[model samples]
Target chain A: MVNILANPARFLRLAGAVLPWCWAAAAVTGGVGLWLAVFVSPADYQQGDSVRIMYIHVPAAWMALAAYTLVAVFSAVALVWKHPLAHIVAGAAVPLGAGFTAICLVTGMLWGKTSWGTWWVWDARLTSVLVLFFLYLGLIALRGAFDDAERGNRAAALLALVGFVNIPIIKFSVDWWATLHQPASVLRIGGPAIHPSMLWPLLTMAVAFMAYFAALLILSVRAEIAGRKLQALLVAAGRNEPAADGLQGEAR
Target chain B: MTAAVTEFFRMGGYGAYVWPAFAFAALVLGGMAWRVLARLRASEGALDRMRDRAEGGRP
Candidate 1:
């Protein structure tokens, strides 16, 4: 499994076969999930219609943390095993992770404004997620900072591993502190605290988001692989003909 | 029919907050999808062109 995953050509072929199914799953599940959320689910007794926001908010928040953990794990593998594809996967994940984090934060704010009567807060859960957003930004900037691509990948990998401490902080912050954000309702030590009517839709949406993430992650990794191949080809061409060697070296 | 549609959109008086939240999530996710597709297309195109160049510009 590791060998197949580590081989880019094989990985690409596997991804090609799986991509269509992923897109189909995402579309089907997302449509059903939306229907359930918008039309089928009952309004919360306390939060009322604003509770509808939970469908989007909870899934986005879950994806945000999940994506970052993926990055950190891939980054670790890339550093320890020096697998180039692992770095590519990690790099592909950063933007999507950041996107999810942004969605979570913004939707949280909107939900908060309705329920909490405030747009901003300095609570630990909120603050930690904000830090997570910046960590993603820092990794992106670091990845592109160095002219040497390998150096940049290594630097970004290091940053990803170092910043992983915040993951637990974000997960536990609600329980650890008194925050406006609710505690983990679906994924907790005890069974999900949520009602079944709402739970099914939320779970479906989570599946849809994950499928979407997988499809996009595959696409981004393929693009990064192609980009790397193009660079390698340019370098090889320069090597065959010594006349343009200086120019190619300078170009790089 | 129209009343039901309006009520759905209104989201029972929290429409302002609810709609924007969902809309922003759509925008971000949709934008990422667009960008990822563009990147894949551009990179594959470049690779094809480079391969053609290696083959002495032969199609």
Candidate 2:
């Protein structure tokens, strides 16, 4: 599958084929998740209604980490095998990852204010996630600074790989150090700490967020390809225009 | 029915915090989707114009 999608045409065809289903899944799962989260799920014994924020906050955080993994994996593939589609995907995923990180931070702050009685804290998990957001921004800026697309892609991809060191830090921060953030609940060794009532909604929201990412990522990649085509066309037009404007003879 | 619904929307007095979280997610995701599609449309239009100009100017 990855080998075949190394070809941009094949990738585009697959993306187009899958995009509608992606949208449908995002909508259906998102709807069900929201209903369960807001209406059906019980309020936390301690946090009360504020626990509803967990449905959104946890999924965004998960996606933030997942998106960076997507970037690093795609970047590694791009760097090793010279896959153009992989580069485009990693580049397009940067902004989405950053957006998810932003959601994670904002919702966390809101929840923190109510739960922890502070708006922001330099806890290990929060700080590392902040760094992850910055890495995404750095990749975006580094790519834009280059004049050539290929150079930009490779430079950004390499930076993404280097920035992946932050991922493990973010994942383990709540564990390796004492932090305001709670330890892993759902994916821990002894099984989920959360009750099934909260757990089901959280899992549904996770599925919704993943589907959302798929739909958005495919759309963004399509747009990025179109933007590249436009740039190539404009460059070709500029090169051909002078020759046809009767300046061809003077050059010769 | 209406009172119960309104109470639910109140989010047990945490509406201020709860509503905004979902709102931010919608705003960011919706805004990005809008921008992506708009740019794609504009680029396709520009490419078409360039192609048309090239063909017409050939004669």
Task: Give Cα distance to truth, residue B59, candidate 2, Å.
Answer: 7.8
TM-score of model 1 vs. true structure: 0.93
State which candidate has the highest lDDT: 1
Estimate, for each residue in B1-42, the C-alpha lDDT of model 1 and write its tens digit: 999999999999999999999999999999999999999999
Assess the local accuracy of residue A250 in candidate 2 as a C-alpha lDDT between 0 and 100: 36
Q: A1-252 in candidate 1: lDDT tens per residue?
A: 556657888999999999999999999999999999989999998999999999999999999999999999999889888879999999999999999999999999999999999988999999999999999999999999999999999999999999999999999999998987889999899899889999999999999999999999999999999888767766776776422423223323
> Cα RMSD (Å) between model 2 and the true structure?
4.3
Question: Which predicted model would earn the best DockQ?
Answer: 1
lDDT by residue (tens digit), candidate 2, A51-140: 999999999999999999999999999998887889989998999899999999999999999889999989999899989989989998
Q: Rate the local accuracy (lDDT) of all candidates.
A: 0.91, 0.88
Q: Which parts of model 2 are misplaced by more than 4 Å?
A: A241-252, B51-59
**Using Cα atoms with residue i matched to residue i, what is each candidate's TM-score against the true structure?**
0.93, 0.91
Fnat for every candidate? 0.87, 0.57
Q: Pick the candidate with the highest TM-score.
A: 1
- Candidate 2 at residue A116, lDDT? 92
